[model samples]
Target: MTGERTASGLALEVLQQLWLGGVRDVVLCPGSRSAPFALALDSADRSGDLRLHVRVDERSAGFLALGLSTGSRRPVAVVTTSGTAVGNLLPAVMEAHHTGRRIVVVSADRPERLRGTGANQTTVQAGIFGTFARCHDVTAGVAVDGLSSLVAQACSGAGPTQLNVQLDGDLTPPDPDPLTWWHRPDNRATAQLRQAGDVGVQPSVSVPTDGEPLPLGPRTVVVAGDDAGPAARMLAEAAGWPLVAEPTSGARIGRQALRTGRLLLTTALRDEVERVVVIGHPTLSRPVTGLISDSALEVLSVRGRSGVATDPGRVARVLDVVPRVEAPEDPTWFRRWQAADERLSQLIDSGLAAAQGDSPRASGAPDLSPLAVAAVVGAAVGAHTTLVVGSSNPVRDLDVMATPWPALEHRFVVGNRGLAGIDGMVSTAVGIALGRPRAARTIAYLGDLTFLHDTNGLMVGPSEPRPDLTLVVLNDDGGAIFSTLEQGGRRYADAFERVFATPHGTDLAALCAAHHTAYERVDDLGRLAEALAESPSGARVLEVRVSRADRRAEAAWLRQLAEQAVPGDDPSR
Candidate 1:
């Protein structure tokens, strides 16, 4: 490949390295400057070497990549044109960076000589991502060796990376088999290959401690956010502390901890806990935020990545410990938390039982309440299966209504908790399924709007073995969760529905057909159970249609259940 030849071929060559390195999906935002990239990826797609996804909006594209990356564990790549197109990716990239998600952004740009000379769409592409990316490469000319090594580094690294390929206009696409630059016999490859082996362990010289454990206070609380995993349970057990966990944390509401509801928030803080040990990201509700602010206590934070400063200056102590794996114990503290956990479990049980007996009201023709759908989902799936909940109402409803499984089974729950967007729910679930083994089944519970938002995530190939996955789409037509908000009255209802809900008359069966996935329209509870019991292989879509009117009734019933379960005169209360 000569300098005069467009680096399109070299770019494709680098992309092939990424594909060979286990990248199954690539999101492309088309542009003239990025035509070469787009073309090469198109070729790869046709040959079945890589799966290409096209998104008009770069912001959505970036997030789609974020979701895919989070689900896949391995880095997923993104391609875009120069200037503002690259800038559009900032929000999702920042979120991915902070949350330690793996993603690679390959932006096409003009040559350096033309950068400052009033080029059409050019900016300081190099170093634009700052410390957010693990590595940034701005390459010009055709050098297979260098580009290949960089591609491997980007693919193998823990966080996101940028490869700004500056191209000359005369360059043309090369033959299909672009050179494998990464496979060259060089020191860089050797070192990177070695570094890949040490991916999970963060080098630590000393494990910091807050002197000695202070006497446990009555109001002391421990809150776990999304991605808290097993570490949250271990922490709560070790400290014997009551845990307030979000749905995405994989901690059951009545079993491992309490849900993040208004009442729980109030009670946890009513006694005025003097200290809080926040693990993972901060995902407390607004009321809890106020409580956290008003409490006269110190906050200690622990996370795998740095720069997540949600507690402001009150984060007296910070540690770089992996959220779910590390177990730091305090026997005395563990006893207090255990008692609190028991009290919360009893309250939740009573609440669920009361809700079950409430009169089932008449919902609309397509009567499918989001809460009801959630109940069906909770009951259908097995204890061992992973549940990847989408953002918006799906996660919130699950947090409140979902009960614990009978036995202790390793179940993982994931969401885009860092920025909490619905753009990549399907893709994230797909990636997560891909990460799991053949025996493991992953179920994705998402809303209708969220399902359509990133439907492209369903694309899978023969090489990318079909995951034992089930997709449960709660087709409520729009954002039903927002209806429960304070401004849900008649006056603002229409406007909210139009702008926020953005209802789409989507033919889910057709959508599944396009992706070659099995589609099952589940209207009754029995059908849902049968489908779950069989647990089919490959990607399957189960569309559970619920009427909007029924959703409202379900919400009302839930509130009543909460009220009756926790009598104002109860001693525990």
Candidate 2:
């Protein structure tokens, strides 16, 4: 090791120490102040010690890092220059905070003397993310041991961490003192701690230990929310209870899992649900919210590593883990849910198929409704594929349309359900796709608004690492989600079109052309499936033009179908 240090030497050591702490991916946005990190990361990438991803937009880089960390289940670092570039990371950092993603922000800053002195690209970078990320201020002259300790600490945290490094004098490395990736002993204990920390920090509370068994007398339903693991399904199956899992929920598989649980909850069965076992964070459906909110039902929420549990109703008994059932419930109870769910599922499928097959529109074109689009995308996912569902209508539609597979062996369905916001979804998918390079294919189903919001994610440098992702953009020309909500009522129809449905007629093909990305428009469901079937080679956009005009009417019709399938008055039909 050299006795005298330089900015590049410090940056290289930081990257080396971070790699040792289990960080395998780095997202770098080029900047003058952050040149040392850029060079250091390039060298690391060349040495094959880590994967480096470059993005011009810090916001996109942040989400890309978030996705990489999520997909890899390891700490990922996003490097940025000082000032607003660091602040641009707030959105992704906020999401990581709730989702428990290990995103390490390496924001390069001017020296302390330059800060608060109107220096170029310098500001109070420290503690910029506030509570969203734990911040560590690194000044010049910091020892290698201290830097390594900080890296270790940053790698093991509840959510995101920030290393605001201040560099002065020279930002570039001398030709003879090039930084290189060095070998280090495998610190298994630290690696394990980093992995364990991925679940997020646990809250300080006295609750039953993990794997505790609970009595099985009450009629319980397992509500598996986004990112909820298979434990939710296993618990439901063990207790012979119905599993109401969201589309992104890892438990959205197996026979016990209901395909139309959200809609089913709108039926008489909701009243009969004496107890609810919730896992992960549920943010998609209002019916599930109403069920858990009802004071009449007992909500036993499984505590997630995010240090918080889903207690939207504020009426919940938090548990350490998904409790085991002492004994299975009566076969009759499970059988009834199965029968009702089967009937409702059939109605939904038939209704969607019939609507797509025989449109009532004057144009005679098959109306590729959002729900129908979701169905095709969901069905197209093979065992080796990873489906990244966007928030809003697409995810909600998938929740209703996706059929529960008997087992989730190789396929994965995920979304940014932490904030449930539509921002950064495209870059998130790209990160996931890149991180999972071995996946047979990666597909992202997103609404038009969500896709447009992150179109900058499509701006990939020619030399930057690209993901083989097929982005299925359901272009309804507006925000269709609000149409199915209270805002879409007849009395509010006057304001609905202008405020709620804020349509933007952007030419998607031209937009993709600007990014130099492959673009194709699919109006038929059959062609959409065939397009998805083709092996993905590089980043491309498949735009499916759909109509939001009938969203409210279709929503009402679906609710009517659900009610007719299983009347609210009787549960034991």
**TM-scores vs. true structure, each candidate:** 0.76, 0.93
Best by TM-score: 2
Model 1 worst lDDT window (10 residues) = 199-208
Give lDDT tens digits, candidate 2, residues 1-573: 434467776777777778767788899998999988888778778777778899999998999998897777778999998889999999999999998888999999888888778877778999999999999898767776788788887887768999998877788877744444233335774576567663322222222336778787888889988878878878888789999999888888887998888988888877778999898899988899988887888889877757789998899998777688777888787887888888988888887778766766657443677787888888988888899999989999998888886585677789999999998999999999988898889999999999999999999998888899999999888998898888888899889888989999999999999999999999788999999998867999999987888888888888888888787667364
> What are the C-alpha RMSDs, in order, of all predicted structures?
5.5, 3.6
The window of 10 residues in a row where model 2 has the poorest summed lDDT is 199-208
- TM-score of candidate 1 to 2 decimals: 0.76
* Candidate 1 local Cα displacement, residue 219, angstroms: 3.2
Stretches of model 2 off by over 4 angstroms after superposition: 1-5, 176-209, 364-366, 568-573
What does candidate 1's lDDT look like per residue over 1-573, in tens digits?
435444774566667667645676787887878877777777677766666777777776787677666655667889998889998887677778777777789888888788788868878887678888865555555466666667777776656788877766644554545432122234664476557674422221113343334354444566666665555555565455667677676545334365434344544333545666666665636544654555366766665443464464453466455222134444444444344444554655555445444644455345344555666667655655677888777877776656554437656677777777776667667656655554356788998988898776676544444567898888878877677665555678668767765678789999899889999898766677677767677889999876564455555555554454444554543
